[model samples]
Target: MPEPVTLRPRGGMIIAAIALVIAAAALVFIAIDGGLLDLARWAWPVVLLGWGAWLLYLRPYVRVSEGFVEISNLVRTYRVPWGDIDSVDSRFALTIRTRGGRVIRAWAAPAPGARQALSTQRADVTHTPGDDDTRRPSDAEGTASGDAAGLVRRELERHRREGTAAVGQTALTWHPLLIAGTTALAAAAVVSLVLPHG
Candidate 1:
């Protein structure tokens, strides 16, 4: 079997971490400026607890091998076999179509100049179908396809035909949920300040 190929969304972890930091900072600033020391005592804990839970629960979990691809976003895990892939296409997003006619989407960072090279090479291969020496052009193509960038495209295509038997999506990152949570928590802190506390 060829070496296992694994592909993951770029900057996913970095972006998540940055967002968490920003949310935490905003919460801290509100607590200090709003004179809600008591509220901070409670709200900070909640924020910390929520942040910790998110770090533990919302992290990306993805692995790909020669035979299958596995991805987990805490809430759901998807395991797609290699045979079910139909075709892989790269545009603004990397899209994979399965044999069952479903499409899966993920962010892909296609290497600069690589796509043009691959297209040129593919065209060259298509024009010379009669070349019997498999070791020449075929080997080069295989090497390119097996590389990390190539694997991203290949896996997407594979997942389409093999059928994404075990895949799902969820808001595991600090996107809308984290932003909303922080806003609500800040609002609650403000309300707590105005209301008389027994």
Candidate 2:
């Protein structure tokens, strides 16, 4: 068996904690400056509350071994055998379907270094033509058909068959909802702090 492949989400937990801290600090600054409370009556408090909730609830780790896949968030952990996986698919999220038909979705793939390590393991597996192991032909024709959906399908199939898949790098997702929500909350806190009250 190949060396155990461990794929962790990019960025140490420390970074995420730090980011939360920075965001919290910014909220504090906004509140003291009377900006948050002014932005919206209840927004800032809500944002802070949500942020805290996510930080407390979101456990973000994905680990794949020769025998099984392990996923954990701040709240729970799941372990599934490779053979139990029915299919893998990637859309807005990456999902693993089990023979029982239950689906587990991950926010994104593992990091680059982790992916590279997994790719190295692929060399030993008997990869079907349509299997994920088949690398895209470097020629133009392959590129033409290599659309996003195709890539996602290919990746899912690859991991399902060969027991490996690429992991996405860790970075700010830039999700609009999260950004807007955070902004709203921060603004509300500031406004509340600033308005004069008798």
Candidate 3:
């Protein structure tokens, strides 16, 4: 069996992380020049931005293996076996429909903008054989959603070709740790706002 393939928005994540690091450093410098209360005030925005970056960019991903496709969302992860997948769509994002009629959207892969759609050549959108009439403008090959769908569809086709496809159930799971961490960070931000400054 081949290794699982992980797909996500690397460029955006890198940029967001770098920007946050710079902001955080600046915050630390400003806090050092001021009193302790000023540090608390500066802390929240950094914490908030860090939380946003962690949840929005660093966390979400789609992992495709020989047996299943795993979608890691904000606070939950869904594992859909190849056999359980009824169809995959790229209308707005990399959306998967299970045989049990469950729809899961991947946050990491979003469709392109108007300008991007307009710039796509025919070669960029020549995806696996499927209905073209329903295909949208942003469903180009280079777009996030389109590329992710391609990876999933290709994997699904491989299973079909090897005669290993079947019907199964999609599994859903939540991350308590993620939930707790997010709540804690949000509370800190709120506390910082309400705290009396000297």
| Model 1 segments more than 4 A misplaced | 1-8, 31-62, 71-76, 107-149, 153-198
Model 2, residue 194: distance off in Å is: 15
Residue-level lDDT tens digits of model 3 in 22-107: 76886778688886667767677677777787788878998988789999999999999999998999877899999888999998
lDDT accuracy of residue 103 in candidate 3: 95
| The candidate that achieves the highest TM-score relative to the unseen native structure | 3
Query: Candidate 1's residue-wise lDDT over 82-155, tens digit each?
Result: 55555544332334466667665433222224554454454444432123343123223323222332454445
> Candidate 3 has what TM-score?
0.89
- Which runs of model 2 end up more than 4 angstroms from their true locations? 1-3, 8-18, 21-58, 108-198
Best model number under lDDT? 3
Higher-lDDT candidate of 2 and 3: 3
lDDT by candidate, in order shown: 0.47, 0.47, 0.81
Per the 3 Å backbone cut-off, how many clashing residue pairs does candidate 2 have? Answer: 22
Q: What TM-score does candidate 2 reach? A: 0.39
* Ranked candidates (TM-score, high to low): 3, 1, 2
